[model samples]
Target: LNLVDLRLTGTIPPALGKLSQLRRLALHINALSGTLPPELSGLSQLEYINIYDNKISGTIPSELGALSQLKELGLDHNALSGSVPKELNKLNKLQLSACELGGT
Candidate 1:
């Protein structure tokens, strides 16, 4: 399914990463928390992922690099900490702010 405009609440379900056919996942402006599920690395076809304006915490998942096709990623205004995953350097367009980005 070509679902757009996604608004997820609570912890991000690991099941979402199983949607191999998913191309664009937009989960902005929600109350999502907890560490980013490593399972998300399974979405091989994912091109866009926006998880801005949420309470999500923890370091950015390095597994996200598995999305070879991912173009844009938004993780602003969250409780996320730790250094930006070096893997994220491959992303062409990413928006992350107001979070610590240099630590163990």
Candidate 2:
């Protein structure tokens, strides 16, 4: 599912985790806020997640590391804090530039 630059607002719905077959998720350049729901780990087939340049905050969920198929994760330009979860090293591409990661 792609909803890039749609001017979307509010938080990303946790119910979206039910989309078991979803492969890619792009919701970048919007007004989306709130923490990423760990429920998203249920997307076993997910490969990429691009939610960049938004108002999202909080730490990257360790649960996301469970996505063994995930290759790219674009979450830059947000208000995220804390160090990246070590469990995410398996990803081939992880983008978190411009995030408030406390020098980690």
Candidate 3:
């Protein structure tokens, strides 16, 4: 689903995780907040995820590495912490801010 630049607010609905065949998710340039749902690991077919430029926080879920099909991840300009899970080394593209580089 592509919800980019829609000015969306509030937290991402965790139920979205149930879309097991989802290939791409775009929720960028919004006001959405809160941590990314670890449940999203259920999206086994997910190839791209772009939740950039939002108010989301928390560490990048290690569970996301289970998205073996994930090739692109756009997570810059938010409030995330922690070192990116080594499992994400499989990604083809990754976006992150300087703060994220210095995070715990």
Best by TM-score: 2
Candidate 3: count of backbone clashes, pairs at least 3 residues apart or interchain: 0
TM-score of each: 0.88, 0.97, 0.93
Q: What is candidate 2's TM-score against the reference?
A: 0.97
Runs off by more than 4 Å, candidate 2:
none
Estimate candidate 1's alpha-carbon lDDT, on a 0 to 1 scale: 0.83
**In model 1, what is the error at residue 42, expressed in angstroms?**
0.6
Model 1 agreement with the true structure over 1-104: per-residue lDDT tens digits? 32223555679889998999888887777778798899999999999898878889999999998799999988888888888887878888988887666664
The number of clashing residue pairs in each candidate reads: 0, 0, 0
Pairs with steric clashes in candidate 2: none
Q: Clashing residue pairs, candidate 1?
A: none
The candidate with the higher lDDT, 1 or 3, is 3
Candidate 1 vs candidate 2, TM-score winner = 2
lDDT of 3 by residue, 58-79 (tens): 8888899999899999999998
* CA-lDDT, candidates in order: 0.83, 0.95, 0.91
